[model samples]
Target chain A: MEYRRSLLEVRDLHVEVEGKEVIRGLDLVLHRGEKLALMGPNGSGKSSLSMALMGHPGYKIKRGAIVLDGNDITGLSPDRRAKVGLFLAMQNPVVVQGLSVTNFLRAILKAKRGEEVPIREFREMLVKAMGLLEMERSFAARYVNDGFSGGEKKKLELLQMTLLNPKVAVVDEIDSGLDVDALKIVAEGINRVASEESAFLLITHYRRILDYIRPDGVAVLMEGRIVASGGPELINQIDRQGYDWLAVKTA
Target chain B: MNVPTPPLELAQEPEELKNIRRKAWNVYTQAPFPDRASTLWRFSSPEAFWIIPENISSMLERGKITYKLEAPNGLLLSDLQQAVSDESVPVGALVGPEFGKFEALNLALWERGAYLRIPERAKIDQPVVLRKHVSGEGLVLDRSLIHVAREASLTIVEVLEGELTGNGNGYLNAVKEVLVEEGAALTLVEIDLTRGTTRAFVTARHSIGSNAELKWVLARFGEGVLKANLGACLSGQGAKSEISGAVFGFGQGKSDIHTFHDHVEKRTFSNIVLRVVLQDRARSAYTGLIRIGTNASYSEAFQENQNLLLSGDVRAESIPELEILTDEVQCKHGVTVGPVEEELLFYLMSRGVPREDAVRLLVAGFLEPVLGHIPGDFREPLDGRVAHSIKPATEVENVL
Candidate 1:
């Protein structure tokens, strides 16, 4: 194992949704700048882990401790967690009808920076980021995610990641609905945001996105717990032989 | 409540004008208080809007009702009394006691009124502003008539405000009648920012002629109680009307709004979009109707009412009704009443914005469709009012 400083640690996390345990006893760790891909079957609680980490009110943390950098953040609110450098890219972004994309992005930026960013400067940054995501200039003026295509929604998630530059990013199935071209652009965006001080936890059900942005490590989650963890070879094994073998072994 | 006797000065007015007032007074005295079982009065009680005769007389004697009008050249803008005496305007033609009780009272006792006539085939570069202010406690009556001549284009902004005195409760009854002639375009914006303690009753009726267009915007931000009846009749072919409204209610405010789109001719078009945001213990009830008559073939009408509840204590009701008597017409109506989506708030909060700020953003977005229709000069002030209304009660009290 490499000797790298840890950025995020989830210790024996137990999450409940609607009074039913989802993430029973999951433990995970991501070191600085490391890209860890979490692979699981359809009902393996992958999305639950992402939502619980972000302090979703619907996802109750039954028992766990989430440490970011060196602070215990299990009791913090969602906005507090974000302020301490945590970001979660939702699987399905909601449609806000009248909130323009530019206004939403600027508001988040202001919240993160604790000060107002000059309009001209913010416009330049937003335009540059939109261009990188292959979005039109008029995209900034549109209401947030309203009437947006599936691929466009995914691109918007990546665009936020590129701009926020958080220390820990948990992207849940960002590649689920993207086309080949949009997947390439989104992959490029994630790679660009990966830095020495930032760690990535990619949650997915397929190996296609892993091919675009290689993962430093792979972990398999099954029935609310991490059943296996290893180097990139784990992904290859899962690709060849589906999770049935891992499930049998873990059981 | 018994109807107050006609003012002594009423006898001195022109015979025609006095006759209209006398007829309206009779109607007001004869009409019974609206029954709660009626659809129009189901959500609100007429007692909340009842005005004492003594208060009305006192306010009238003290001259507490005032009006200011600003218009361009070649436009006919005059006092309602002058316009009626000169035989230049037909008062009480569109609205009368038959409309409603409050409307009849407004027509009979209105002390502050304006009549605006736009010349034929003329285009006004600037909007005509009518500001009606009631400065003392008691009952205030106001009426206005606007006629946009054929092929003429004009915009009118009506601002209603109140300044209460002492511990007395204030009541305001207002009526407006607008006529858009053939091929004319009229944009009427009514902004009501009455005091929190004032009870307001407002009724407006618009008639659109052949090939005419009417755009109506109503922005309500007052507290206390408000009952508004806004309607438009499409009487000619190729006529179009678009009504957009936004209301923000806070504290213990109660608001009941009704809108009507009556299509009487073929090939007419109408759309109504109303958005409301309620905070604190505020409550709102919205009922809208789209009626396409048998002769209104090939007409199209759509109505949508959306209410956003900001607190658990707040209540909202939305009812959209559609009546289509002819086949070849397209009529649809939708009503939505719900609290802000938790998913939306979570999405915004996950990006570092606080919960309060996130809720504010969602509410502002929910109201943007209608608020965006406000004129540029008034948009910012209304935005401020909305922002202030959404704050926590304790914080709002502190700021106040």
Candidate 2:
């Protein structure tokens, strides 16, 4: 008997933006229901990798294969990628006026299922999600990300991640601009949504978000390539020793 | 051309600007120049006043002018020519009956059950509308006078659809009045459709009562030319007024928007946003102004005009001004003319919205702020019409 498993295999991915090569060839893999933390310094292409995987038009994938659920999605659209259970909670979500928060959520759900859910059932699920995120009902009436505080926006993104229940989520700097209290809420939101059924690739510059996520695998990215791969304690070591492990490179 | 007057009830005396009418008409004559100037004109092309022949009676034919309601028995569109029954025989015995042409036009177009005499003191419902369709190169005009009684509410939608179905040019001259009694509220949505050389002049006058809410929304479409005018007076204290507009055109088409908000009493408020998109050598101009009078205090007025140039050949001009007599006020004005944000375009395209859908979404987002001014009843048509106006922007990139 074979056990069901989930995996995201990025074999030699090259990403470009505005014709400039940004993320040079890189390779990494996350197994079913596993968590991978991608840490990098500023401008090291951590966010670009995540964006390219989500099919952001801003970044072009010149080469490489992104296989999720046994299918190569190297050239898929962002929405198409999202439909296949790929999610990206951007550090700064676009503030779209006149488009209510409930609207985007409903649209994503419909796009994924190709059908709308019963209003009552959807509302019930939404209520539970909001309650867990400690969000007020009035927030639902407002436009998507419009005039919301940075922390509020993160919570809302987390709520969406939970509701959509995607197979893979690449979060870019989820802990930025959050207070200690807000950070705790956001981390908890991520924890609540993450399950044994899905895998997550958490990208960040700081080690704070890892406090709650507890990545099953840790990868350090330097100059567009993965420099090291280890377990959770490697985060504590990196935070204290700082990538001196780069000089004693092993092929 | 003569018709009877429906006795206008007057409480406050009219302050005649008789001496200034010449200046107004003279200013109206200097046009075709690029940069829109003057707060009174508000981002409007000064050259637009003469886009159509001033002498329209000589060119129009009765046979070509006809209208019908899509939803039979719901509303019938009668030829406004039939309402004026006497005199004013231009095309001498038109395709329809002889009456006040404006009346006949309204009657023919809205002849069905929607005679909805608005009750004073009622809350305005969503989807407020008054739609009029014109299918000829003849002189098309619509005139409506409504009074929302003290504490009452009302909404009106007027749509000008040109179906000359030929290269023949059409002209539309329209005037509408909204009399909001003390504490009354009113929202009016007006649409101007110009296709194949169609040209039109539309003027609207609104009087907002004390503590009343008035939202004025206008949509300018078609590859034709249009000059839309809106003026409002906040007569009662605490009255608030909103004026919003959008004009989308291509292929040598031109559109102009002129708006004026007059704050007469204390605590009067005004806000406006006019969005324009031009392509294929088309041009759009906006001229707007906010006037705060001496007696007005605590007045707040905001104005912004934004134009998206899709191509280098497309030209967009904007002028926004503010005149405040009382120093105690919060007033600001902004004008922006540029192409769509490249980041936004790339973002949407990355999502597989298609480059065209991406442009459409960006343009639609620019117009989203105006949806608030539209009453619920007119939302569907308003949204539909706006979505169609989001033309590709690259053809008008050089427009500025």
Q: Estimated TM-score per prediction?
A: 0.94, 0.74
Q: Give lDDT tens digits, candidate 1, residues B279-383.
A: 888899988888999999999999998888877788898877888899899888888888778888889999999877887888889888987877788777787
lDDT of 1 at B240: 99
Which candidate's DockQ is highest?
A: 1
Chain B TM per candidate, please?
Answer: 0.92, 0.72
Residue B122 of model 1 has an lDDT of: 88
In model 2, what is the error at residue A165, expressed in angstroms? 3.9
lDDT (Cα atoms) of all candidates against the true structure: 0.85, 0.68
Worst 10-residue lDDT window, candidate 2 chain B: B88-97
Tens digit per residue, CA lDDT, model 1, A1-251 = 66899999999999999999999998999999899999999999999999999998889898989999988889888989999999999899999889999889999999999898999999899889988888998888899999999888988888888889999999999999888998999999999999988999999999999999999999999999999999999998999999999889987
* Cand. 1: chain B TM-score: 0.92
Q: Candidate 2, DockQ to 2 decimals? A: 0.23
Name the lDDT value of residue A138 in candidate 2: 91
- Residues B129-181, model 2: lDDT tens digits: 45556665555545444556788765666665655433444556555556777
Q: What's the lDDT for residue A194 in model 2?
A: 80
| Weakest lDDT window of 10 consecutive positions for candidate 1 chain B | B391-400
